[model samples]
Target: MIEVLVVVGPGLVADAGLLEEIAAREFAAAGVSGTLVRARDAAHVLSLLSPSSPEGVGCAVVLPGRSAEVRSLIGRDLGAVVWVDVERADGVTAAAGATHLHGRGIGGLAWGIRHAVHRVRHPSRRIAYGPLPEQWGELYLPGADELYLSDADGPPVVMLIHGGYWRSIWAADIMGPLCADLAGRGLAVWNLEYRRPDLHGWDATTADVAAGLAALATAHGSDALPSGADGAAAPDLTRVAVVGHSAGAQLALRAVADAVAGEAAAADGAQAAEEDARAAAGEAPAVDGVRVAVSLAGVLDLVEGDRRWVGTGAVGAALGGRAPEGQAAPPYGDASPLLRLPLRARQLVVQGAADDLDLVDFGRRYARAAERAGDEVTYLEMPGDHFDVINPATPIWQATAQAITQALAAGPTSRG
Candidate 1:
């Protein structure tokens, strides 16, 4: 008779009972005769898998949960037994499957398994940026904290925006390792920290990002020179690019639009108030003048916020209830990149084929909108979920880095 072993990671001894139940159910359903064996820890599991064991156990099912230490132990001994992982989050099982498990019927299961694998592989990075010794007016900068690899400095600065439905609890620190990997490639990285809902409301968070960008630029002396090509006398500001994931992507686009609008309003206000000229002008306002924008698994359409894909209250919070609707959308269009696509920025959007949040359709919509508006937009559909793009070891991460490198190498233009 074939035998199966269930190895529970340390601290999850209680899950052994549940693993037994699952194994029994799955094995009976699949017409496989197997007995479940529980291991106290990863080492115990490895010891049991040795050739010295009773010779009948066919495969080992390792339920390490999120413990990377345990997973590493099992991976080293994978050749000895057919390794399987049972992922658990918050004491609830997330997925169970073999290491090489694949099939159309198990796509969702596979995605969950991949997400767990990614967590084990990449891990998080930690970093801190200040509530500076000098405050910016009454704001009392809260000193942003994030996870990023140290020593990220290249010709171009790439900013990675993490998506936590725009909530503060999910900071950019989650993407720290990925930032570090990019930094390892000699890319200057600004893993930003901004006010989120827990700290401040949506509008405040939005303004905080603008302030943060300004502060970052000031700190790096990016504003000292006029706009010009990369490697020119232009202070290397030309190659700056923003890579935003999920809600962060929406925010990046809005930042660009807001920057343009602020400039247009200020420049025009200073001129003679030519009502007819202003009314007849067809040019769109630009914000922050972002040269290139990339969105990974982004929620781009705010009008569809109430839809099951985008989620409602969160989008409302992000826009401060000021998002435009119907014909009104065009007037306040600067708040969304979809509405602001007329601005000629080089844009790239990547979405996961199995994204559980916002779905890949959201990224597709934004890409189509940008392309229709005459912007150069590249949309890459990778195989993974919403969080997979930030996985340091994944091919999606490499593709993102390459895209940024290519965009930065293209130099800068005043238009986007």
Candidate 2:
């Protein structure tokens, strides 16, 4: 029901024949039954992209030059703009300030087209958790009429945090398919988008995650979400789950630990210590309604990750500094989930058998450490690579989703 403009830049910048071929393949795979228009140049493309353009074109797949006019065409409301660069030119399209896929060569173009089609079919309501541009999340809910009229308290909410080693080039669009899949299964999904440490610093990234979680928990009764064809509703916080991938897994666990600590600090002195002790003994801590937390091919142990120089020292960059020489200190103590053991929520740690060996080690060791700290944990090690866990079509994700569904169905675990 959407029109896609595959703009082939004049010159050797793009392969016109390959562009058309990929577009055809992707459109067919997406089951869009939509129209694809090939434009010879940028001007030709722009003319066809108008609101009154023929056949109602709503999105573009562009292979562009480094010109200002080309970059300015990004981030428009015209569905989605996906910029393609086969030579892996770093961060160019991302710096254009748009929701796009770039730098993966031909694969990027194919995924971008699929992403564009997905957006048109499953529209999400954008809700801002803070005033900043990066402080927002896309909420996807079951759009059925019965869902709106049902008196029952809505579906369980799932908060998804994406990962690209905390870099700006990788945005929440990476989680698009997973979000749509979960929403289709009748779960309200909040796909969180936050400031990356590379551009906004580590503190900002962590703070944004915390604020986004808080906003998700409180959105139900407030005027924070706007209603329309998207039908954005406050998420069902009574049963909430946080699902984070890669570096985002660390963020998810850290947020839960922070929430547990805050709740303990606010209680009566002796009672708070008693509750903390109980929580550390595998009992549910007195915190908000977050029941389960899942980590997919996660970077769980910052201390070890830093020591091993994981992600080419991305751990240190995310924390804003390298780990101290002798004893791991400061940021690692506060930010690392391994250091903050016995999080109040039940934990689900999933890792690909063939992923970075370091991540497999992290997942295994962290699950054991969490168990020793009296936290309930379910660890699933499957056959696949790093990206397989995020791809909705993969068996790994199917198993992960099954685990999550079973956990949610079990309801809140009774305190031991």
Candidate 3:
């Protein structure tokens, strides 16, 4: 009998036990079955896999969105691990690392049902922008719009990062109408879809965010994609800002902070000699490009949100219960925009007082903290609900547009 370790990252956790039952069948069919243990994050799974032995577990079944982490596992039985992926059907396919688990047995079947319902309820014609199948963004609008920026080589791209509390259950596809609105208004839009915490965790989600942004940046510079299929304009990443809602707001802020942290450190080396020494020491110059964050009712202060809503456990789910240590690198500190302050670019936070009380507090508190940290922070408190801010038909979206316009006018800066 083979011991099967069903590593339930963030994705399978969303399946609500359906995938567990399916996995049992898969293992039974393969004549490998003993104990079906459930593991949370990769760290926990690795710990249980036996520190003394490399191939401890008979076989490990990793769920979706964990391809990156699973690929990174060290000293594991390469041939015994199976990655759970979903394409057309649910069956175990061949993969370079371990084994590939594919087919409808995937939790995507459940997602398909819900996604279908959502697609119907929220009608949108936004396209998915990606060369890879997993990496897709809801097309709000492409590079060129009916009306380009009044002053620029081309319209700036407004990458839309939707918020579902960083959960896989909440997809970027739900932000269709909002993307359409932005694209319709002469803005290039890329509604990014990332692997939520379900399959892997925050690490995967954050990595996807970086990859999606890079893909767009590459696409912008590539001559291959001159225009959209409809012959619309191509996005210009040289002048780009992120318009993120709720949890996505926090991510956008973090990206800006991470991208500019090096520059901020270099700025401390005020003396030319020190700067020259650092450069001689193989230090890179601060990246200069279009950078700004437009947050819509975002949960910027995760530390505060976790404390207030301790019962709900939303923050724990996003950060894997890794509490902030006042000053640390990842798992928590990197996740919190409040801690990653002193950003070089401007941040326009359009918060709604009528939203969740914790989220509201996050917006207000984050704005104050940003100001204290010398970031160009603009906090706007409007009379709207959480989701209302993303609606183009509403006045709140107009405020978002205004913020974007200002950021575009200000243009790019090398303050990082």
Candidate 4:
């Protein structure tokens, strides 16, 4: 049977007969027999699913500002244009928001009217790296609030880690307009806000992102960065970079593989017998440095993203439950950042191509296992889904800010 589907937003187009009553109760609850049609957007539902338009038995397209043309027909359509954000939750979750299947499209509608017109035209600057309250984060840009905003110390430090699958029902202000479009490009945006793996599982969201990245590397080793409006010079945390999406790109690729396995355990001396028993049963803190990272359509193989329509299982609801059956070690080996491997850091792995079916082959299986354990992987492959690389009105957010300036001008090459 031929399949063609497209479902955009504004509450699925103010109700076009509830998209043929949800494709006739999903083919009568799978007894299998399809027929549902409606197209006034997504380019009139891709000229009726191309290959010479006229196929039947599988088409459900609802329209309405098709959120800036569903990323050029999501991965050449086989299915995966499910966006329905209508501005994030409140009262019926913002009138039914979070149907979330943007497979790679989570930002559009003029990137949410350019981050609510830059939060009422520039308003941010709360900083605290740690000392809890989710170890504080926000710093977004565009003259943060004016006092000498951008003459230097900005561009470099992306950080950002928003993806709801880890639940607490999604936060980090859904990457506040991609952190105000990377702090209006002078780039120095943190946007963290942790703790939601159901209160205290996965060690309270990996120790609040390792105490807000060890209070942002002890305030970038005491240069105390954080300023924008009128007087800049704040970001550039020694050239840091991390960008995450879906499940915060599996916690920024397992905290950049535990900070490149804690700098190979302090240059191969002691640590690592499971990091001295997860630091004598505590979990994540010394927050080492991350070279570069990004994951977007993430979920990098957490045992095939723990079931129930991906992210609905959200990797066993963020590793706090599922384990028993013949359990021969199923606890997501080091919490599945592609089973921890080759992490000198320099990964990209953007991915999209209509992102569901559990993150459309997770950036080609984590760039073929971080390029077979040598790590300096790139693997871009764009075209929207999984919230279109955090939707800055997609072009996959300028190909993910030019792959984070080519992972900050590439350094450590890997592929032993």
lDDT of each: 0.54, 0.75, 0.62, 0.60
Prediction-by-prediction clash tally: 12, 0, 18, 28
Evaluated with TM-score, which candidate comes out highest? 2
Model 4 lDDT tens row, 22-139: 5555545434444444555666566665546665514333333345564344434333223234334221111111112221123322222223223444456556664544456776
> Ten residues in a row with the worst lDDT in model 1?
134-143
lDDT by residue (tens digit), candidate 3, 1-416: 44555555543434546666666555555455534445566666666556353445654555544444543553355444545445432222333334342443465433332232333333333333344334566544443336556344566778788887776545565576676666667776777877777556777677667656655655555552355435655556677887788888888877766656644555687447645853574332322354687788888877777767632778777788746556555666777888777676788989877888778878888899888887787889888898789777778778878778678767565474
Scored by Cα lDDT, where does model 2 land?
0.75
TM-score of each: 0.56, 0.85, 0.63, 0.31
Among all windows of 10 consecutive residues in model 3, the one with the lowest summed lDDT is 88-97
Off by over 4 Å in 3: 1-133, 139-145, 150-152, 228-233, 262-288, 322-329, 414-416
After best superposition, candidate 4 residue 193: deviation in angstroms? 16
When 2 and 3 are scored with lDDT, the better candidate is 2
Over all chains combined, what TM-score does candidate 1 have? 0.56
The CA lDDT at 194 in model 4 is 77
Assess the local accuracy of residue 365 in candidate 4 as a C-alpha lDDT between 0 and 100.
76
Number of colliding residue pairs in model 4: 28
lDDT of 1 at 410: 74
Residue 137, candidate 4: how far off, in angstroms?
Answer: 17
